[model samples]
Structures are given as C-alpha cells and as structure tokens.
Target: MTGLMAGKRGLIMGLANDKSLAWGIAKALADQGAELAFSYQGDALRKRVAPLAEQLGSDFLIDCDVSDMAALDRTFDALKARWETIDFLVHAIGFSDKNELRGQFVDTSLDNFLLTMNISAYSFVAVTRRARAMMPEGGSILTLTYYGAEKVIPHYNVMGVAKAALETSVKYLAMDLGPENIRVNAISAGPIKTLAASGIGDFRYILKWNEYNSPLRRNVTIDDVGGSALYLLSDLASGVTGEIHHVDAGYNVVGMKAEDAPDI
Candidate 1:
C-alpha cells in the first residue's frame, strides 16, 4: 500500500504478539517495503514471532534477552552477517516487576527498582551503543515510552521512573550518535489492550478515563502509534531526534475531563 519505507532495513525488538506496538510498526514498515528482522526473548515468544516475521517475508528472526550479553551479542552478530549495515532499530522493550509497578514509589525495593531500570531504561542505552557501531551511514533509533514518565499514573510507579530515565537516555544518545547522523527518539503512546498491558492491574480504569478525556474521545490503538513510528524512522523525520512524540489523541494536552461526561 504505502511505500514510505522502501529499501530501508530495520530490526524490531519486543514483538510479544500481534497486539504489540512493535507489531503495528513492523506491519506498517513492511507494507511500505522496509526489510525487517525480528528478535524474541525466548522460545515462547519465538513461536509467536516466527509466523509474523514470515508474513512480512522476513526470515531474520533471532533470540535476544537484554539482560544477557551473550544473547545480545549473537543477535547483532547475526544481523551483521545478513546485512553489512542496518538502517534503523525499533526498541519497544521495557518491563518492571508487576508487584513493584502498583505500589508507592517510596516503598520500592532497591532490588526491584534496579532491575526495572536495567530492563526498561538501561537496555535502550546498551542496544543503541551496539546498533550505532554498525550504522556507519547513520540511521534511526526509536523506543516506546509513556506520559507517566513525566506525570504520575497511579499504578505506574517504578515503570514510570524507568521510562523517565529511558526518555533522558534518548536525548543523550541522540546527541552522542548525532555526529554519525544517527537519530534517537521516543514515542509516548496512550494505553492499548495488549498482553503486557493486561498484566498491569487497574488498566481498565486507565482506559476508561482516557476514553472520556482524550481529545479524540477514545483511547489510542497500535496503528496510531505505528504511523508516528513510520515518520520518525523515515527521512520524513530526519530533523526530529531526542523528542518524545505523543500519539495519545491529544490526551496529553488536556488539563481535565469534561464536566458533563459520564464515567469513561
């Protein structure tokens, strides 16, 4: 349909299922002819990713665990073997222990806090460092974030902090990789009903609130976020970097819900 990403090649991490934001972006890019490779955490995810990768005509699926350097090494190594250079990387990976995600920030256990940062924030930095090495021609790097990074979302606790750090890392990495013309940015999307989201308690409440307050009168979908992703990774957004683009149907711009509104 659209050929906006023609001839480009990108690697996408964190495609847990068809409902994933990463899947939405991948489908858009594939529709536009960007060659793609996917990475899954383990065999469980691999099964879901294989058929999807095949659907896009990509057989370049690899296993990667951000916490494991060995797995990270092999993933990029395999990509290098297939293509001398990569044009873009989509990092939709982030996690926090569900237990820590729902409580008071002050009560956060140091162990879980650090683990959250490592997985949700540090992984972005680590992956960018590796991807930059092979992007001699300069390319694009993108990560997913949330508005909670700036404002508190009741149960978003530690994950919000992690996303805040991840957003800052985007700026620093964008500056560091700038010399090479590599751009790094983030997308702060509204809530979606995905497997990962379902794990977060109180997600239903968050959804209902957004439906009533967001300017679009609805919650955002994976496709809406995907469209923004296509722009950032394409030459269309060559001048955009170190920025957090919100695809929340203008929800972030609102101060409060309408007075006459029934419960979302």
Candidate 2:
C-alpha cells in the first residue's frame, strides 16, 4: 500500500452490496489506509453493509436516510461524536422507480420525477451540508454521476435529468466550498452491472452497446471507477474541484457509432 490516505477518516454513503460502486470506492480507500464509516438506509441493507465495513476494519456504521432531515442530523451527530473532523466523503446514492425506467421520458410521472430528484440529486446536498460542518480544516467530496446526464440514453429518462441537476449542483457546491479549501467533484462513470443498475431497462444491452462502441471497446467496471475516485479523493487531485471527470472509457467523446461496431 502507498499509504497515500494513511491517516484520513471519512464516511461512505449508499453502499448496498459487494457489487456496489460504493463497495469498490470503499475498498480502494481502505486499501490506501484510509479509515472509513459506512451508512445504510434500512435494516435489510444494514446487514449487508456491516460485513463490508468489518472487512475494511471499520465498525463505524450509521443508519442514514438522506431524504429525511432528522436522520441526516443523527448521522452526522454520530460521526461527530466519534471523530472531531474527517478528510473525505463519498456519495454513491441514487434511486428511481423501476417501472418508470423502461418508458419514454415524456411519460415520466410527477411523483416519480420528484422522488428521483429527491433521492438521486438532493441527497448529496443534504449530506454535504452536514459534512461541511465537520470539514472546517478542508476536505474532499465525491459523488457518482453518469453519461446519461449529458446525452440521451434510452430508458435513462428521469434519472438523466436528475443526474444533470446533480452535475450542476457539484459545480455550485464547489464554488460555495472552495474558499474553505473544500473540494467538490463528480465521476461520470460508465454502465456497470450493480444492484442499482438492474432497475434500468435493457441494461444488459446498454452494457453490450458500450462494449462495442466506446473507444476502449469495453464497458467499465467498479474497479475502473474506484481508481479514478481514489485519485479525486486523494491529494493527487488537490488542484481539481468542480469537475465532472469521465470514467466512461472515452464513450463521451464519440459523436457517432464506430465503423466496426455491430447493432445491438
């Protein structure tokens, strides 16, 4: 281990299971000697997250529902009780109704639209508000985003809009926190077969399409994202902030399908 993060302590929000992007980020951080705390929303996930935390040699777990103000308050209160300050925070949370994920964007319901925005977009803001309080000494904040926010992906629909809003929030938050030496940024990762991704329609096809067309000729994995995240969260990226760094295998640069690509 490089011990690049040898003494840092931070919280990881929205980890669900082994295949989660959060899990990859957690492992990368832990391997670099960073101390970690994990947060899960409900009982079902509590069981899953506990073992993951233990695997990382961490027993600091908290129940946090970012959409709820009181739960957020309690989450940070618990964190503050344990550590007077933290060096970083990772937000890998997002959600949307599965039923709405398959249809046209025009048909998105108001309820689901609002719900998606609340969970996928605003939760970052909520958590950052509390996390910033503990970062008087300055720190790093990272969130996961996607290419769907910039280009229309079939079935990405409302979630795309939500991610767009989230990207904007990152820029604004970076500006708001820059004076404090706190950096805010995001990773627009390629499609990965995580639990949260299964909810999107024809996800497998999307994966395959990316494999054939991206400049790397493959879809990205959590490990790929983990490496990029590690850099952003570490002092390696101290000069960076408010950036939507793409970890999408160069997919964002393509204007048309590759000549060798096959139709999915």
In order of appearance, the predictions have TM-scores of 0.97, 0.98
Q: Model 1, stretches more than 4 Å misplaced?
A: none
lDDT of 1 by residue, 1-264 (tens): 348888899899999899999999998888888999999898998889999999999999999999887788899999999999999999999887788667588888999899989989999988998999889999999999999999989888888999999999999998999999999999999999988787677999899888888888889999998899999999999999899999998889999876756864
* Prediction 1 global C-alpha lDDT: 0.91
lDDT tens digits, residues 143-199, model 2? 999999999999999999999999999999999999999999999999999998999
Query: Model 2: residues >4 Å from true position, as ranges?
Result: none
Clashing pairs in 2: none
Each model's lDDT:
0.91, 0.94
Which has the greatest lDDT?
2
Error of 1 at 253 (Å): 0.8
